[model samples]
Target: MAVIATPVDATLQVVVQTGTDDGGRPVTRVRSFRNLKPSAVDDDVMAVAKAFANLQAHPVDSIVKVVEIALTEEQ
Candidate 1:
């Protein structure tokens, strides 16, 4: 038997430093862009993330790519 994995969906997340917590720790928030193509290139995704980050009031801390996959047994 063999297993196969298929990409079902994808998302891009931009983590920004909104501010500091009461204890002075950095507070962050995730801005998620859903329905992204799973076949998107890393560089292209990063460019889009940076473009979106520029519009944010806070500075970006990181960029994340989330992909959902479905696994099935090959018949």
Candidate 2:
């Protein structure tokens, strides 16, 4: 049987800013994207993040942070 080639995917971490810390900075929580396309645009990601963030208890006005990470497999 011929082996099928699959495109490699990266992980995306969406950090949502809910409230401020004691230092008055931003506080964040990480949300992972299991399979993310390498060609994704920041705007599109942010838009989706904002939409998802709405489901959270935090107000939709909270700021969002999107970080892309490579997935590691265990041997």
Candidate 3:
């Protein structure tokens, strides 16, 4: 049997440093952008994330792409 994976949806997550904890640990928050095209390229997504980050008050810690996939077995 062969299994195939198909991308159904994508999400862009931007992690920003909001502030510091009482213990002085760095605090982070996630900003999620949903309904992105699953076929979006990495460079394009990164570019968009960076542009969005520029509008944010906090500094960006990281950029992540989350994809939802559907798996099916070939008959």
**Better structure of 2 and 3 per TM-score:** 3
**For each candidate, what TM-score against the reference?**
0.95, 0.45, 0.96
- Clash count, predicted structure 3: 0
lDDT for model 2, please. 0.62
lDDT of 1 by residue, 1-75 (tens): 899999999999999999998999999999999999999999999999999999999999999999999999999
Query: Candidate 1 lDDT (Cα, whole model)?
Result: 0.97
Q: Going through the candidates in order, what is the number of backbone clashes in each?
A: 0, 0, 0
Where model 2 places Cα greater than 4 Å from the true spot, the runs are 1-8, 16-28, 59-75
Candidate 2: the clashing residue pairs are none
Best by lDDT: 3
Model 3, position 53: C-alpha lDDT score: 96
Q: After superposition, how far is residue 55 of candidate 2 from its true place, in Å?
A: 1.0
Displacement of residue 75 (Cα, Å) in model 3 is 1.0
Query: lDDT (CA) for every model shown?
Result: 0.97, 0.62, 0.98
